[model samples]
Every structure is written in structure tokens, then in C-alpha cells.
Target: MDYERARAEQKLQLQELENIRLEAYKNSRLYKEKVTAVHDKNIKRREFQPGDLIFLYNSRMRLMPGKLRSRWDGLYRIERVEPYGVFHLSHPSSSELIKVNGIRLKLFHSEKMARNQELEIFLLEDPTTADD
Candidate 1:
């Protein structure tokens, strides 16, 4: 019967549509994972040593009314560098030590700049051309 044939065709079409949808979902998940891997690869690795000075990021600074205010606070010295992004910091004025995430801190390079200022500069003179 023609009705039976048409019903079989309709069932086949529905099955094909479901297969296509599943394939699409698989592709989307793969793409998302690839993007995440690339992002993690691009992140810079931070290393800290004991006695190094660093600035801590103040998460609450954004809530303040002043737009010009710096989000980074503290010139704390690194007392210890623990595994897995944990840093122990101590302030010169404070006796207590604080443990913070390494992601929230950046090394203060002011000491490097001071050492760079002592470098001697040489002025080079070009040889005079006789054709002039």
C-alpha cells in the first residue's frame, strides 16, 4: 500500500534528522575544547622568589567612586613562594604575613630600573668623508 510506503519514508527522514543533530552537537563540543586549550596555552607563567617586591591587585578598587585610582595596592615583599600559585607576602610596616594568589600579584621592577641607571653610555662619531 502507498500509505505504508509513505510512513516508512517519514520514519527514515526523522532518523536522519536526529543523526545530523547529534553530529552537530559533537562538532560544537570539540570546537569549544580546542578554543579553551589555546587560551590556556597563551597565559604567561609567573615566577616569584623570596625577598622580591610585588604589588597586589585590589579586587574592591573597582567599586570605589574614583576612576583614576589604581587597582594595584601594596609594595609587599615575598616571604615565600608556595606551590600551585600561592604566595606568602610581608609588608615592611606590618609584622603579620599574608597568603595571596599569584595571579593577583605582579613583580615590582623598580629595583631593576635603579640598576640600569648606572650603565655607561658611549657616543660614537662617524668618520668624516673627504668628498664633502
Candidate 2:
């Protein structure tokens, strides 16, 4: 019967469409994993300890009109480091302490540089000519 043949064709078409959908889903999952891997690879890990100095990133400035101003604000000391990248910071000039996410802060490299007492500079000299 023509009706039976048409029904068989429709079932085949449905199966084909499902196969395409499944392939697309697999591809999407693969793409997401690749993207996540790339993103995780580029992430920089930051660690802080008690008494360590750090600078806090000011994310609020992006909405404001200050383009030339520096976005980092601090010289805060890490009073404590909590689990999951949370830090307690205290400003040098203030007694109040605040809890902030570690991602918003970066170690103050000045502490390391200041410890080095020696400064080195290299100067390049030109060869003198015999006809001088």
C-alpha cells in the first residue's frame, strides 16, 4: 500500500534527523570542552599568605569616566587567606579589615624587588677607529 510505503519513508527520515541531531550535540560538547581547556590554561594562579602585601583591582572604574586613572588600588596587607580564593585585607592606614575575592588582588611585587639591594645596568660601547 502507498500509505505503508510513505510511513516507512517518514520513519527513515526521522531516524536520519535524529542522527544529525546527536552528531551536532556531540560536536557542541567537544567544542565546549576545548574552549574550557583553553580558558583554564590561560588562567594565572595567585596565592597569598598572612602579612603579604597585595593590590586590589578596582572593577567599578569601567563604568565611570576615568580612562587615564589606574584601576589598581591598594597596598593592603593580607590578614588572612580563606578557602576558595578569599582574602582578608587591611589597609596600611586603616584598622578596618575587609574580605575580598583573591581574583581581584595581585601580590605586590614591590616586596620582592625591595629586598634586592643591588641594581645592575649594562652599557654598550662602540669600537674606536684607528683613524681617530
Candidate 3:
């Protein structure tokens, strides 16, 4: 009788352990689903239109003029739109224009252009010529 009781206890313990492991896996799957939902909600999609100026990311070939610099270069007009948000930009500096994706471009706003205009005025203004 003692041996039978010991065997029964061992079986119960194994079942308990399996239940605990299944619970842990269920919790982990739930956590992963929640995290993925939050991440998807927070992701933003970018779109561009014609005449919009964009700053191209420097990931092109080494021979490209903007490849050496990482920061924003002068404005380039959007000449054509391609699949998956890719665009073709035209600038006077280059004959072949560049093709870049939406992820590699940042939208330029008029507010930034106004700020640049103000900075240029400040640099070009002569302090002596101004009436104080």
C-alpha cells in the first residue's frame, strides 16, 4: 500500500509541473501579442507628393555627391514616385538625380525654410548700416 501511494504522489507532482509549464508558455505568448500590437499601432507611414522638397539619406554609392555627408543636403524636388514609397529627386547639381525610399527621406516644411531665410538675413545684414 505504501508503494502504491508513493507512485500516485509522483504522478500528481508530474502533472502539476506540466500544468505550470503550460501556464508559463501561455503567459509568454500573450505578452508577445500585446507587444506586437502596440508596436504596430505606433508605427507611422510616410508619403510624399510632387514638388515636395526632401532631404536624402546618404546611403548611395561613394561616387554620389551626397554619399560622403550624413546630414541634410540642399533641397531636391520630387520628380517621380515609385513603388514602396521610393522617389526620384531632381537637383541642379546632378545630372542623374537620385532614387531614395521614404524611409531614407525626411519631409521639409516651410517653417524650416523660413528659419533658414531668417538666418541668412542675419548673416548678411550689416550692423553698422542698421539704425539702432
Candidate 4:
């Protein structure tokens, strides 16, 4: 009977559609794996050591109204460096130690300046000294 033949053909088509759906799912997983590999390869490792001077990001600073205010609020010293980018920081004036991620810290660089001077800048309106 033609009806029997049509039913058999429909069953074969349904089986083929199921196989196609499984193959699509497999390809999606493969694509995600490749993307993850590429992302992991491009990440730069951060390293820190004890006694290093660094600034820490203050997450709460963004809540303030000052648009130009600095969000980084640390002159913290690295007291200890732990596994997986964790750092223990100590402020010179504070006895308490805080643990933070290395991603929240950046190395602090500075040059020694004269004691009575205002941080390496000359007042344009001020009278010049005899040494000038």
C-alpha cells in the first residue's frame, strides 16, 4: 500500500532530522571550546612581590558625586603575595592588613622631590628667587 510506503519515508526523514540536530549541538560545543582556548591564550599574567608599593582600586569611589575625583585610593605596601594573584596590603599609617586581588593593584612609581617644594611644579605668578 502507498500509505505504508509514505509512513516509512516519513520515519526516515524524522530520523535524519534528529541526526542533523545532534550534529548542530556538537558543532556548537566545539566552537565554544575553540573560543575559550583563544581567550585564555591572550590573558596576561600579573605578578607582585612583598615590599612593592602599589595603588588599589576603590570600588566605592564611583558612588561619590565628584566626576574628576580619583577612584584609586591607596599608597599600600605589598605585605605578602599569595598564590593565584592574591595580595596582602599594609598602609604605612594603619596597623590593619587587607587582602585584595592583584588586579585591583598597580605598581606605584615616584621620584624623590625637595622637602619644602610643592610636588615638582613652579608657581607661574610667584616671584623668581635669586638662584633663578
Query: What total of clashing residue pairs does each candidate reach?
Result: 0, 0, 0, 0
* Model 3 residue 28 distance off true place after TM-score fit, in angstroms: 1.3
Tens digits of per-residue lDDT for model 1 on 1-132? 999999999999999999999999999999999999999999887798999899999999878866556788879999988889899999999999999999999989977779786877664455589996
Best first by TM-score, ranked: 2, 1, 4, 3
Task: Give residue 125's lDDT in candidate 2 (0 to 100).
Answer: 53
For model 3 the local lDDT of residue 82 reads 85
Per-model TM-score on C-alpha atoms: 0.76, 0.79, 0.64, 0.73
lDDT of each: 0.90, 0.88, 0.79, 0.86
Task: List ranges where model 3 is wrong by over 4 Å.
Answer: 59-70, 111-132
TM-score attained by model 1: 0.76
Candidate 4 lDDT by residue in tens digits, 26-96: 99999999999999999987677798788999999878877666778779999988888889999999999
Give per-residue CA lDDT, model 2, range 1-132, as digits (tens). 999999999999999999999999999999999999999999977767899888999998888774466688988999988899888999989999999998899888886688999968664455589997
Model 4 TM-score is 0.73
Best by TM-score: 2
Among all windows of 10 consecutive residues in model 4, the one with the lowest summed lDDT is 110-119
